[model samples]
Target: MIRSPRGVEDILPSQVSQYQWIEKEASSLFSLYGYEEVRTPIFERAELFLRSLGEETDAGKQMYIFQDKKGRRLALRPEATAPVVRAYLQHNLYGKTREWRVYYLGSMFRYERPQAGRYREFRQIGIEAIGEGSPYLDVEIIEMAHQFFKRVGLDKVELQLNSIGCRKCRPFYEEKLKEYLKKNMDRLCPTCQRRYQYNVLRVLDCKNENCQLVIREAPWIGEYLCEDCSSHFQSVKEGLKALGIKFQINPHLVRGLDYYTRTIFEIISPVLGAQNAICSGGRYDDLIEELGGPSVPAMGFAMGVERVLLALREEKKGIPYKRLPLIYIATLGREGWRAGYELANLLRLKEIRVQLNTSKRKLSSQLSFAAKRGIRWVMILGEEEVKKRRVILRDMNSGTQKELEWEKLEENIEEIKS
Candidate 1:
């Protein structure tokens, strides 16, 4: 038997209900926050990521890249924000309104060692607000994630936040951070040493045991934030507090992407242990301009749907799928087939889920299948029932049977529901 590709998963039928439940909840919440849906292709030019996500980050390093039939370098999207930003500018989303709110649900591909809640190909539900840079919007996005987890019954989430400053003050912080790392270079890891020169801010995010200790006491980004960035960061905290959402300020919480300027955050849960972040995003004021589009300030975050599902499982939460509907039609002979089809259609037109027996099994076997499938109302249409202009509605659970007039079938299904 051929196996699925490594790090990919088949979301089997049994697990689909959970996914649907999450999608429904996400749709409702996003609508409440005034975010419209936007979609982009699964693959784009490889350089789009290199230019937008940064050539230095691991996304550019470990993405699944190949030459399309036309020989243009292409890659499965490793993240959603970059593509959404592209569409925002291409379609002039920010022209009419000062800010445009959008959300997307899609798959992202990355070449990484799979573990609990992390996969090579994963689904993400993300939201982006692009146009003017407003800290109120920043808080609203953060609160949106918080509210999402609460609605989904997640109890182990932590909100870690930071400000990476902007063009003016970030350079000063980077220089200072680089100087601090240079002094401690002898104790730093090789990766930290290399990153120190190119992107010193990333050094703070190093997870190596020794490298973490080396820069444990480095200068905090919040202290170095310029006046405007400082005030904006403060407003985010105040706004979140006003909305009764709690957060923690972590000085080392800088984003790996080059485009993010301020207000980076992660909603982490301890259930996944060390790799704990389930949802993460922040402000990206320069990405639109950097990607060759007109300057537009944007902020958004992506939630790993697989990770959220795993968290749901770990927490032992239940996703409720509607019970299989009342009507299962079993036709005994060829003539009954036409009658069964007509009755099933009429019942469904009244908004009922009706399943017609496609098997040539005996009545006993047909009823057994209906019972096993949790089909409560089994409608039997033998030759006599069709001739009599009636259908036998059998209640599988109670082992009761009744004959309903053909025109009263819709009324009978409604009574069952009631």
Candidate 2:
């Protein structure tokens, strides 16, 4: 027998309802905020990620990179933000406008050790606000995430936010951080020493226990924010407060991506163990120009669907699970089949969910199958009922049966809808 590849999954029909619930809730919320949907290729030029997500992060370090027949380096997207920004530039999405709002739901690929809620292939729902760089836009996106979690019943998740200072102040802070690390280089881990030269900001996220200890006292970048960047960070906080959104400022929340500038955030849930962040995003004011497009500012966030399912399961909030079919048409013999098919077609034309049995099983067996699939009503179409131009509709829930002529089925569906 053949086996499926590692790190990928098949979402079965039984679980699709939960998936739909999350997507619908998120889609409705994003639409309410005026963010339209956008989609991009699952793969792109490898350089897109190498240049945008940062050359030093884990995604860049561990992505699934391969050469196509044309010998162009291509990679399955490890994250969505870069590609969205790539599209924004490629299509001139910003054009003369100062801003645009976009959202997407799709799967992302990464080659990593699969453990707990993390996977080699995962689903992500993300949003990007590009063009304008107001701190208010930053606050708006963050609030959207907060409210998304709140509405999804994961209200316990905490919002950890920080400002990673832009190009102007980041370099100065990096120098200071390197100097601080230099004094304790021996005490620092090898990775920290390597990061000290190129991207020391990432050294703070190191998982090595001793490395964390060495950098525990290291200077935080927030303290050294230049005046303009500092003011922007302050306004972001005030805006969050104005919207009644509470947050904890963490000086070390430098996200793994390099393009991110100024504000960064993570909506973390403690119930999920080390894999805590359910949703996260930040600002990248220079990413547009960096992609060789017009200079524009953007902010966005991504939520992992698989990780969220884990948290939702832990919270024990009941997602409605029902087999609420609109109508079920049961057929017995040749003549009944024709009538059942006609009735099924009519109900479907009226936009009703209708199921017809094609099996040769006994009436008992067909009824059992309908009940198992949660078919709410069963319209028995035996020869006798077909001859009368009527069908016996039985409410599987109440076991109540009534004879409804063909014309009355549409009305019955309306009553069900009501």
Candidate 2: tens digits of C-alpha lDDT, residues 360-379: 77888989888998878888
lDDT of each: 0.87, 0.87
What is candidate 1's lDDT per residue for 1-418, written digit by digit as tens? Answer: 9999999999876677678888889979999999989889999889999898777776777799999788999999999888988887778766767577889998999999998778899999999888868898898899999999999999788999999999999999888888788889999888888877666788899999998887689988888999999999999999999998888988888777778888999999878877778999999999888888787888999998988988877878776665466678998988898999998888778778889998788989999998998888899999999999998989887898999898776677668776
Clashing pairs in 2: none
What's the true lDDT of residue 120 in model 2?
Answer: 88
Q: How far is 81's C-alpha from truth in model 2 (Å)?
A: 1.5
Query: TM-score per candidate, in order?
Result: 0.92, 0.93
RMSD values, in order shown: 2.3, 2.2
TM-score of candidate 1 to 2 decimals: 0.92
Alpha-carbon runs more than 4 Å astray in model 1:
94-98, 322-326, 372-374, 395-412
Per TM-score, the best of the predicted structures is 2
**Model 2 clashes, total count:** 0
- Give the number of colliding residue pairs in candidate 1: 0
Which parts of model 2 are misplaced by more than 4 Å?
186-193, 321-326, 397-418
